[model samples]
Target chain A: MVDWIAAFSMPLIQNMFIVAAIACVLCGVVGTLVVVKRMVFVTGGIAHTTFGGVGMAYYLMSVFAVSWFTPMIGAAVFAVVSAVIMALPAVSRRMREDSVIGVLWSVGMALGVIFMSLMDRSVVTPRSFESILFGDILLVGNTELKIIAVVTIISLIVIATLFRDLQALTFDETHAKLSGINVTVMNVILYVIIAMTCVVALNVVGIVMVIALITIPAAMSNMFTESLKEMMIVSVILSLIMAFFGLIISIGVDIPPGATVSVTMGVLFVVAIVVKTAFGKITQGKME
Target chain B: MIPIEIKDLSAGYDGRAVFSNVNLELRDRDFLAVIGPNGGGKTTLFKVILGLINPMSGTVKVFGEEPVVSARKIGYVPQNENLDSEYPISAREVVLMGMRSKKGIRPFYSKEDKEAAERAMEYAEVIDFADSRISKLSGGQRQRVYLARALAPEPKILMLDEPTASLDPSMKDCTYDILRKLNKDGVAIMLITHDMSSISHDVKRVACMNHRLIVNDAPEITQEMIALGFHCVPELVHIGSCDCGGHNHG
Candidate 1:
């Protein structure tokens, strides 16, 4: 094996690992709520739908010469707007949640494609749209790492500040409302937080693979935890392990980092389910 | 002090009137069982009082303040079906949720808050299951956990929506006994239930609700009043004086 220790000396490789660590932490913290609240589909919608913003930004840059605007900003804005659209109707029974998600997913992707098609690639920094679909983690730079770090800190602070209210809302929204939590406002805040997470994590896992990183570890952790807090801690640890292993494997095999990481998570999820089932059987036998 | 006062409160959703022109006053230390059919405005009334839904017209005041503003002093137990059993939460953690409004940007619960959670669990006789996962509990046990959660914040009034809908008869008796003890302790109790037989003699004041409010039609609810509230003879009406049998609806 090539000396992994020497590879750490390269700033790019170093930044990649740091970014992975921070991304995994964010996934673990926010993904627990996503799993418990059954918002995986909504999160997926936001991730795929954010392409609309990405497209809008590129289109603006090509046509209007708005050189300062970036796809990241576009992605963030699109993600927030779509999340609000999908989430508001969900709470009020105005529309079925699955239908809302399905509609947004398709429309968002179509908007992104249309925008990208209309852009002139020569005038702006060329980021391959395909790379965005399946991440380019190897090319993550200092600026991307800084952005990720800032988002991670903000997410932690927001989650910490609203911990109890969030707990009530996730467990029982009506109870949360009666507790004077302003459930609608809290729901909106959660959607925004999910939007931010999707935008920041897009750099590490991309749109196609972000849901796997956000949910598989959380599901695995849920199998072993009695409380949401415990689940979050366990999930963070599992996500870090998967990301590190997946990163090393991708380098060794010369494959796409996003797909490798997602496959690693999928394999771990299966392992967890098997182990939990076997452990349950063994314990039941002992009890008998 | 009157813990709850509703004056000409008319509320509904999606522009349909579930109830209108209602007036209600919940006296201190009173155990009022709100009996009605499945969708005959009982829940709408509860929503109005809990400030979850705004009224189309008129006004609702809890402790002489707007219901939304006074929500902190009102302990509420929603229907058991509202909570997902698959969620990873302990009984004690669920109880601590009752103190969320009181917590208010504090990063952690204080020692006194912890004591109150413990005390509430003890009151509901579920202290032994404080650390148990809520999903592992029996239905009756889960209901008690929810009761403890509602009691944790120590509100002047406790509102329960369909607390005994699917429980066994013995469990139903236990739930009523707990509410009676809480009522004796000077906490005003308002329960919304379809099965009037589940409520005991301790619940002297009954509010019959249809598309409108009927307050104190009798010291005890009459079958005629139940018929009015149900709008039709229910398939399985479970009142002490009624003779309806178990009839399944498809």
Candidate 2:
């Protein structure tokens, strides 16, 4: 335990812990809306689709030899664009939602692969792709931590200010509209928030694992809570616990932190579902 | 004063009209029931009046202005299919949504907002399940909660689209009775539904729309109006012993 305390003193572990806490809290709040709004597939699409921007940033950095260029900017831009593209068809009622999402999902990945292959071979490397897919949480830098913190604050402020409008919009959009809430504008803002969240959480969990972080904990919370407030509270708590446990286990077993974090949350999610189902059955039997 | 008025309104999707050449006027003390066949542009008319969709041509005024401008004075209950039952909200919380328009910059609900929500819940007879999960409630209970949500804003006019679609007979009767009481309290109501039996006695006026608007002060439904409303008038059913057919002397 003394060694464990000392180990946490290292800046790298400390950064990992800080990022985990921030990401969990952010996911907890945002995830509740995502699940309740049924934006799981859309969010997943945004996450995967951001790779297009990642590939663009990589190709540009190599071509221009600009050390200042980073994938973070690329991810932000691509995420927003992808979200808008995905949201347009659904909002307009012109196309079926699933088909549009499916198309964007594959097109995004394909565009990323194309951009990567088009890059200069000498600059492109296999290790770079691995870092994007499976994040190296042990290497989280101060810059990344700052970015996450800023995003977390922004997310909190926006969600807090729009809490009432969001509640109405999510529950009954027609009523919200009649109540003078701008449904279209609010929807765009929500998608943008989701995009920014995806970009901020990308470094902590990587593109593949970020959706799980946002969705699983919220879904777990939904199994028990009755109100959106309670769901958010419980989800945030669950995210922090999962993140802490995953971080500790990664340190102990010498495994990749990102994969372990997602796996830990996933296993716990399954366990929660089973327990809730069993408990529900027993209670229902008694009532009958 | 007229709370809702539409003149020569033509609205639809993809530039194709769902309703055309429509006209209507709703008075403050009016309890109007809009009944027609499925896909007869009933919901579209409500959307136009609610400012969800723009009219292709013609003018619409809600409370003597653009519908969006006076939206705060209007309470709307959409089809229950539009409200997801799986949402994580309590019955009271659902009602509190009515106060959202009034909560401009305040992050939290005020004492007055809470009081209004409580009163609305009480009026809707859903105070007992104020804390219960909305999804766990039965169909009738959920309907009551939604009605309370609409009433929480204290709107001058209430517009409901098919509030009794899936309810049992007794539940349907209960819902109609509540609407009648609200109407008696001088709240203007615009109800769009297919079940003419339950609402014919409660409403003061009747309208039928199938791309065109037909309004009548009496509860009687004429065969000419039915022919124009349903495009064929296959068979007319009498509602409330008021012969709904063969009244050509309009």
Interface RMSD of each: 1.5, 1.6
Query: Taking the tens digit of each residue's C-alpha lDDT, what string does model 2 give over A1-288?
Result: 237978889888888889889888999999998999999988888888888888887788777765565677788888898888765635548777777777877887788888788877687442377778777776667887888899889988999999888887777777777777777788888888888888877777888888988998999999999889899999999999998999898889888888889999999999999999999999889978
Which ranges of candidate 2 are over 4 A from the true structure?
A1-9, A88-93, A120-127, B103-105, B229-250
Best by DockQ: 1
**Candidate 1 residue lDDT tens string, A21-111:** 9999999989999999999989999999988888989999988988667787898889999888766735437878888888889999999
Candidate 1 lDDT over residue span B106-195, tens digit each: 667888889999999888877877888888887777888899889998888999988877876666667777888899999998888876
lDDT of each: 0.84, 0.82
Candidate 2 lDDT for residue B18: 91
Clashes of each: 0, 0
> What is the lDDT, from 0 to 100, of the residue A53 in candidate 2?
83
Model 1 chain A: which ten-residue window has the lowest total lDDT?
A84-93
Writing each residue's lDDT as its tens digit, candidate 2 over B56-111 gives: 99999988899778767787877776679989998888888888766664578888
Residue pairs in clash, model 2: none
